[model samples]
Every structure is written in structure tokens, then in C-alpha cells.
Target: MSVWDSIVGQQAVVGQLQAIVSGDPKALAQSWLICGPPGSGRSNVARAFAAALESPDRGLSDEPTNITRQVLSGTHPDVTTLATNKVTIGIDDVRQLILTSEQMPSTAPWRIIIIEDVDRMLERTTNVLLKEIEEPSPHTIWLLCAPSAQDVLPTIRSRTRIVNLAVPSTKAVADYLMASVNPALPAERQFDRHVAVRAARLAEGHIGIAKLYASDTQVMSDRDELIVGLLGLRKASDAVLLADDLIDTAKSQAEADVNRQTAAAEADFRRINGLGEQDRIPPKLRGAYNAIAKKDEIKRRATRRSRDVLDRALNSAASIYRDIAVLQNNAEDAVGLINMENRTAIAELSARLSRQEVVDRLEAITVARKRLLGNGNPMLVFEALFCALIPGRL
Candidate 1:
């Protein structure tokens, strides 16, 4: 399939990118910024654009050529990608990428450097990158991806041509999920239309989360448990217990994810160094392994990842209140509901709580997210949030 086919619900942006690749050489910019919300396929679009730029026919062919495949797999020598798992991209990483950007393409028409999570860079690090973007090499191209253009410095934003991507419609997401199901799997294991639609709506236009919800029954069950638990909250004691549960769950999930990534990194390092799984590392190679797998950085990343997990939960919690507000205001048709499967519970909550109460709960969720971002204590933050969510407490 064409590389562009994997890009979901971004026809307009894809068209713009294709035009740049096929249009006059003078029209091409050295730097480009792709901005979108989480799970909106920002990095996918960047990779596709990189592939198209490097393709012999500029991705005009129906089938992706060898060069396109290499770029997408991140094996292309001319394409350098910086995707950080940590909360921030370090200055040293960006400096190294800058040095790479100066070299011309080995074989492809243009060398591409893709930076995912450009928004994670600090001001000082962004300044270091700004100079390179300002004076990019003729054969080099920089593609930066972020949740939004405002996340980056104004200087970097102005220097790059910006491509803004919107969230795909719920139906689009559902259809994509349904089509993505492997026919080779048993019917029971495959996602049906109903499951696809439900997951898509629950994800609220987040393709990645929708896929997770569709494929993993556990994810959907966990979300249901969380929403049901929140709606069932009736007292301060219930709030405290649930808050603790939330913290524990987020920490456990984050640690599991971090552990998996660390294990894979170590395995890859060992494989590259020609060491067996059971082989002892040489003293020289131990330092190299330690450099790549820093214990301190892993701990920091786990903390941040846990905060991210909590933030997603906060978003889901807010969505329930949003649904309740919609029902209370009789704006169901206009605003629609995210948690439609919980209509009965939502209706009960709507009747029990005033519109103002629902609004306050939503505001509290917003505040909790901000506090989490500001490095507030998660346990205290969630405790205060859950307490604020008590019905009629506001």
C-alpha cells in the first residue's frame, strides 16, 4: 500500500505535502512543522512525508518503493529521527542532530531529520536548534512534530512552514479501526463494527487510544471501572480510596511500560555489541550500556509517564461530566455524548447534580491536569480532585 494510505483522516494535509514534493524545487522549504493533538498521527504523517520526499517518484506510485520502505522503517541512512521517550529532549541530542543535518544526502534527493515531541525541548535547547533551522543546508529538510505549534518557541515556529492537522471524525476513526482488523485472526478475536464504533466514540477522536480500546478488552474494562467508580463516589472516604487507587494504577502501568522499553533497549544494545543474552558485558561495553540505559533518566521518565497516565484518566473523567452536562442541558443532539454506553449512569448523575455542579467538576478536572503538569503531588492532586467531584459538594 502507499505510504499515504496509513495516514488516517488527513487528506488535505497529505495533499499539501504531496504538492510540495512534486511541485517546483524552489517552493520546498528546508524546515516544516507538523502540529496536531495526541493520537492525531503527527509522527506518522511526518514519516510519510519523509518517505515521499525520498522516493524516486516522490510517492506518486501506487506502491511504496524500497526507499519509501526504508524511510518508514527508520533504516534509511539519509533519514535521521529523534524520538525521545523521556519528558524532554536533551540539548546534547539536538546538538548531535544538528551536526548530522549539515551532511548531504548519501543517495536520496533530500536528507530528512524528523523530531517527534519537539514541544518537549526547553528554551535553551530550542535556541540551539533555531540556528540550524535558520540556515539549513540546501539538500537537508527538518520535520518537527508537536501537539501544537504554540508548544515551540516563536522563533522556531516562524522559521518553519507549519502544517496543522485536525482530529478525524468518530466515524472515520471507527471505519479505520474496523478495516485494520486482521482477517487472519478468528472471528471472536477480530473487532466487529459495533466494537469499533464504541471504541472510536470513547476515544474521542484519538486513533491510537481507539485502537487500544478495540484490541484490548482490559483497557475498555479499566476505563469502565474508572468511570463507574467516579460516578459512584458519594463521600470523602470513597474519594480518598479511589484517589489512592488511581495513583497506584498509574504508577504500576507506567513502570510496566518503562520496564518493557528498557528491556528492549538493553537487548538491542547487547545484540549490536555481539553479546549473547546470557553473556557478561565487558568493562568497556558496560559503560556504553550504562550511558544508553541511565538509571536516573529511567526513574524520571517513569514519574513523567505516570503523570501522563493520570492526565489521560483525568480527561476521561472530565468527559463523563461533559456528557452529564449535555444531558442536563438537553443538548444531547447538538453536543453529543462521549460516554454513551454509560447513558443510564450519566442520566442518573445528570438528574442528581445540577448543571453548575457538573461544570464545577469539569473545571476541577482541568485544574487537576494543570497541577499535575506543574509537578504537584499526584496523590494530593487526585485526592483534591476526587473530593471536588463529590455530587452537590461544590
Candidate 2:
């Protein structure tokens, strides 16, 4: 009946975690890897362990004493969590996490650190982390989560114990949705159900994604339609329109992201210039011009990527519909690389296309994705993809 019990379909993982809980978790080696598919509760399970280790049940009390409250929150002696706030977790952040690992807890009995999306850590970050993992820290523990065990470095993986969370079934996802949504919601309304269903269908056992899909059906619908359209290889007018839509959207996202990065860079630049005015500017600050230059470069890359993302989004939209077309025609399973959302549509479209033709369409979409990421011209990529999708039609 502990908090760990709530995790669904992860019996083996739960057993392992429970054993770790029963033993001297603080004394245990400070490193462990929790591997699971997306939405499989990897982070949740890890957090639950951190909470229990920090809990009063373990006899340690790192109580939270705020101005207004006593946050008995996981009263464990020492626990710190690090994760990606940006799109990537670079080396600097990982270095900070490692530095903190060397410190003694301010209050908690045991020191625990959780790194979510450990796979997202850049190469430099991972390299810095390797040293910390290799060293000893009796009171400190590390929990890293990733899509798979292979996602991390061999040295890091070899040193740590591993726990794999189970992928819950659709029913389990649905049941979770039933319990997780707002209770005040009208009984007849199936908003949560719709989301859970879509996530279950698309994410294919990713609880995080299922919840996301369930939480925002409209967005999912829009995303699904977009993918469907792109893959289906619509008309020239449609392609132009899709390209325009993607370009506009990418422009906005790129600008925003660039602005944020630019602002951070400019702030540092100003601080450096001020220091120089007072003759306090260090070599590092003076060298920060390179940093500023790099920021601009990254902004430009992101700007370019925005266009690519828009194109990919459209391609994904087309693929979904193409899947429907093929599925309807009794097309071979080979074409349905991912979830087959519209079986009826696939069956219907299959009537018009040969099995090879449907498979070709799917392949075209895949090629489109690769081309975009590889800096393949989007206009040309989309054009080629459309031509292939439509066959003899121009």
C-alpha cells in the first residue's frame, strides 16, 4: 500500500524497487538506471523512490520549514534532482549536478539525486558525469532515467543497477485516466477518455504521452490531421498551402526561441562590457564574445530548424492519412510503421492504391523526415514526396 504500489503493470520493477526500499538505500551504491518506454512511469517510479528514501518512515527527517508551512515533504536527509529545462541538457548543467553530489546534505539523512531525461544530456555533460559516477559517495544516490538502457554510456550503465518499468496496457491507461481526471467533470463527458484512448493508441504504452493526448485532444487532433495530410500526398495547391503554414509557424517558434537565447547572451555581454569599463573584466568575459557569436549561430540554426519542423509536421500529418488509406485496402502490415489510427481510411484508400503504392507512400514520408533533418531542401523534398504519393498525377 506504499506509494510505489500505485504504479501500474510494473510488478517486476516494483519488486526490485521495493527490495531497494527494504534494504539500506542510503548505503547502496549511489547510481542506478531506470529504463522504460515513453509514458511508462520511469520518472514517476524514480521520484517515488526518492520520496520514500526522504520520507520519515525511513527514520530521517529533512522536513521543509517554510514561513507558512512545515513541508514534511520527503524528509530524507539529502536529495537533489537535475533535468533539462531547455530542449537539451548541456554539459554545464551536468557539471553543476556533479558538484552538488560532492556536498553534504543541509538537513536530509540521505542524499539522492535524480536526473530525468538522462539521454538528453549532451556529450560533454555525459563525460563530466562519468567521473562522478565512477567515484564513491556513500550517502549520495543517483537515479537516471532514459528511453532505454542503451541510451546511456556503457561505463555509466555498467556501474549502475537497472530497473525496467513495464508498458501498461490500453485498459490500464483508460483506468488511469478514469482516476486521474477532474472529478467535478460531468459524468457524460469523455474528454479524458478520448485523450487516454488517443495516447494509448498513438504513444503505444507511453503513459506520459497518453496523458498528454488525453489532456489536449484538440491539439492531438490537429497534429493527427496534419500528419495524415502530409503523408497522403495531397494536391499542389495543398502542398503550397501546407508549406506556407509550416513556414509561418516555424518562423514564430524560431523567433521566440532565438529571442530567449539572444536575451540571455546579451545580458551576459552587457555584464561583461560593464566589467571592462571598470577594468574588472576577466579573460573569460572578454572571451564571451565568442559565446555571443555562438548564440547567434545557434539562433540561426534554430531558425532554419523551425522551417524543417513545420515541414516534418506536415509530413507526419500526411503519413497518418496514408496509413488510413493503406489499412483500408488490406495493405500489408509493413506500411503501418507506427500506430494505424484510421483503419477505415486505410481500407478505403487501399482500394485506390496497390500494396506497394501504400508502402511507397510511407517510405516517402520517412525519406521526407530524413531529408529535412539532413538539411535536404524542404520545398524539393515535399515536391518529390507529393509526386511519389500521387503516382502519375502531377
Give the C-alpha miss distance for residue 293 in model 1, angstroms.
10
The TM-score, computed over Cα atoms with residue i paired to residue i, of candidate 1 is: 0.85
Total clashes, candidate 2?
A: 31
For candidate 2, write residues 1-394 as lDDT tens digits.
3555447667777776666666864456568899998678887787777766555553222342231021124333366667553556878777777778888867665567889999887777787888777774666778899989998878789988888877887777767766765343455644756566556656556676565456644546656765555545556776666655556555655666566677777666777467433355467665765666575677666856576345436445554545555456556465443445555555555576665666666777778777876767766776566656664341
How many pairs collide in each candidate, listed in order?
A: 0, 31
Writing each residue's lDDT as its tens digit, candidate 1 over 1-394 gives 8878878888899998888888888778989999999999999999999999899878778888999999999999999999986668999999999999989899988889999999999999999999889989888999999999999899999999999999988888888887765354467767788888998888888888888788767667878888988989999999999889888878877787788788989999999989999999999888878876688988887887787678779979989988887888789999699998789988998989877777788888889888887778889999999999988689
Deviation of model 2 at 301, angstroms: 17
User: lDDT winner among the candidates?
Assistant: 1
Candidates' C-alpha lDDT: 0.88, 0.64
TM-score of every prediction relative to native: 0.85, 0.65
- Residue 390 in candidate 1 has what lDDT? 87
**What does the lDDT come to for candidate 1?**
0.88
